[model samples]
Target: MDNRSYFLEEQRCVKKNGSQEISAHCDEELHFDIPPTAAWGTTEVQLREDLTEERQETLEDTANAFQGRGRVVRNNTHFCALTSCPRILQNKKKGKMGVTFRNSASEGSIFIGKRTVKDGECCGVWDVAGKYSIIMGPQRKWMMFSRFIFMDRLIADSHQYLEVRYRNGKKENKRGPLSMFEDPIVHESIAVMNAVTVDAFEVIVVYSEDEHGNVKRNVVHGPTVFIPDVNQWLHVFRWHGSRGKDLHEKVPGALVFTKLRTIPDQFYYNAEGVRTADDTSLTVKVMVFFQLTNLEVMLNSTHDPIGDFINALLADLMNFGCSYSYEQFVQNAQQLSELDTFPVMCGRASAIGFTIGKVVYRGYAASTQLQNLCESAIKTRTELKLKAEEQEQRERMRDYEVRGAHGRGDAERAEELAKQEHQLAMRAAQHQESLKQAEDAHSKALRQKEQMAQVELAAKVAEEQAHLAYLQGLKDMGVDLTQYLVSKSEKQPDKVLKVVTAPSHFSALPINSVSHIGGLNIHTNV
Candidate 1:
């Protein structure tokens, strides 16, 4: 690893026919129509004359072989149809700006020209020439990052040092040994983006290290499932998706992936025992929406502040909960995801969590492989969350009291209300349990239906295989089914010529269709 710090940059380029062949050699000769070295993610940018242009690095998603008759799909709204995308195509049509993970957009046209730039600024622009989103469907992804690289010189490395590290708590007292998730496992170079919230959010420290074992922690979240602060997480709600078969599932058809949490409309928080706004006895039921995304995680309360803010407030309130357990993590996610409030009896207790810090996003050289890492992060988040919940339940049975200034008598009436509030909450919890059971049943039914469909598909494929075998057997016996099935008055028909002009083109051939082709289909050209 180089002792000096290295800056990773992402750039955009479009490859066209007759252009220099770009196999795996994109690192050597690449032309950038819009080098947003100073444009992407910067507050201000000006082109450099006194300074040298920044050298950016972009990982190759798909290799360049030649394929003819490529068509462009514009304005595809779905995204999942693009996920698991085997590869992305490079379109080098002049006047056609290409789509890329690096953000670069023109001030005039979406795909026309480069926006203005400054020397030290890394431009945050969208690669907008309507490239299809493989996993997300036809909707292409725009570039998002904290910064880009500025270079005075370009020194190509046969292999540069890239490492990944993870930290659970504060940066000052970082814990754990550095682990590497590299090459095909961690595609798409690491880039940083700013988070809106700075308070107590759960943060993971991540970054690539150099070959010399020198480590850098620029990335805060990689393979981390938990996102703190609803206000900062960037999220997409819904999109379409495609399958393994070459058919568009969403319209203009494609696979789509959407972020569910970023921009929630409303947040729900329970207001069980809090005093009314007027200080008189008042009952209020409200929905609290705790919205989170790649940028922000914010809390919005309805009439009941406790309903909306409790989960976040509890992070500061109940500090005894452990992070190692799933119950704690889930209780945190639920409390955070749910709404909560305050101004209750000191004796009353509620489990809550907060936004300790930032969670980073990282991937292998190929973004597709990130799914395995993503799946692991997701599972870890869920399991730990569940453990936290069970621990919270045990805490409920404990009793405690706090002094309210100068030995003054605590409000007995308030204490009574708090006890009843706990009972009310217990009843509500029962109802929630019932709701969960119904959901489980519904999910099971869906799984069964899907399994049956797969079984039927397999049966059909197998039947087709058997029939093909029988046809070959007949051909081996010197019997030509095509001649046998021809018109009774006809002489030997030409076996070399084509018959039944059109054939089914359903990616995987339908075995049933072949059965209806009459005896002539049995004449296999063994």
Candidate 2:
């Protein structure tokens, strides 16, 4: 447009219900670099290509590995295309914000912090505004694209035009620089454009960086919002970046961005059908990041960066009458917030004075509550485990006492048994002594009795001699001689002795009867 030329490539048709739709689009192909960090093996974007035979082959070579031009891909083949823009500074304080370089050092410990810049700030390498590009699929309707800058600057000077190019796979003129400044000056507030919606956007990425500088990526289907509305908020604003450990660490590299919502309102094509603005102060501080690396972006819903330009063309803005309102927050939000989020905005547009739907607000509230519950549950579990350990320690002390008592009882029983065993041994010795004394006494008594019996027997022998003399005298006298002689025969009528006796009667007396008849004999046995 520097040469005063005009051609419309993309336009917005405002739906009867106030939502905008892509009604008419020119058949076009524009190439933007596959950010070196491209998520889908798309290393560079082909925003605009020169239709040169040599360049075509190169394009094919670069895009050969890309699946459906990175709309989606298999496995980890998707990588976010990354481009390092030279630094530019706009800060009135500290220093300016401009492109800077870093040696891709493998060593850790090298971390860069945020560089702050203030208003009226401008710093691009002279005659070398850092070049940026994009590669995309061939589509008739223009969707939206996203960009991240290290810093921000408001466009105070007249304007700067965006150069664009496109190409088809046709080897013969298959690709070439499609157009430069396809639309007029975009994003910045030009006299002809509406305020771009550069505020309150979301960047969802589930991604991580590798030691070898590889990035794994996936695309997040973000909340749907009017693309132009997204662009207006993207206008030049301050950004802050920080590095820290996350899911992947030991050492981790991360850049989180915080942006100032600059676009301000719903984007529309302006009175000249070229620029846009709004009545609502649709702006807030929100940070955006592509948590997903290679979207395998089967469906990417990136917000428009040219919101103001698109809004200018919408008939509703003119009918609604541009009224402005700004709602400022008392505190800054560093993490993702639910207030005035995209989903909320979808159901209800919360201008400084707009009303919101109840269901949408409730959903956001529930989401926050769920996150809190998870955190609380984790904390509670940790506390309970700590308490359990304390109880276990107490139990150990109690068990120690019980074991000590059991050991003492065993020792006491052993001592008592030893005393009883000693008493039994003494009793046994006494019994043996008593038994020996009784045996000695019995032997003495037996000897005495034997001597006495012998003495008595001697006396009896003398008496028997005397009796024999008397018997002889009687025989000589011939008085009853026959009676005396018969006595001899009667002396021994055989007496039977009893040999068997009961054990209890072993020492009982035995008796023999004498026969007093003609030839009987009598004797007593003890």
Model 1 lDDT, residue 399, Cα: 26
Tell me each candidate's TM-score. Answer: 0.15, 0.16
How many steric clashes does model 1 contain? Answer: 122
**Per-residue lDDT tens digits of candidate 2, residues 245-311?**
2311111123223232222222111122211132222212222221212222212332222221123
List the candidate 1 regions with Cα displacement exceeding 4 Å: 1-411, 483-526
Misplaced by over 4 Å in model 2 are 1-410, 413-417, 424-433, 436-526
Consecutive 10-residue window with the lowest summed lDDT within model 1: 77-86
On the 0 to 100 scale, the lDDT of residue 309 in model 2 is 19
Query: Would you give me the overall lDDT of model 2?
Result: 0.32
Clashes of each: 122, 99
By summed lDDT, the worst window of 10 consecutive residues in model 2 runs over 103-112
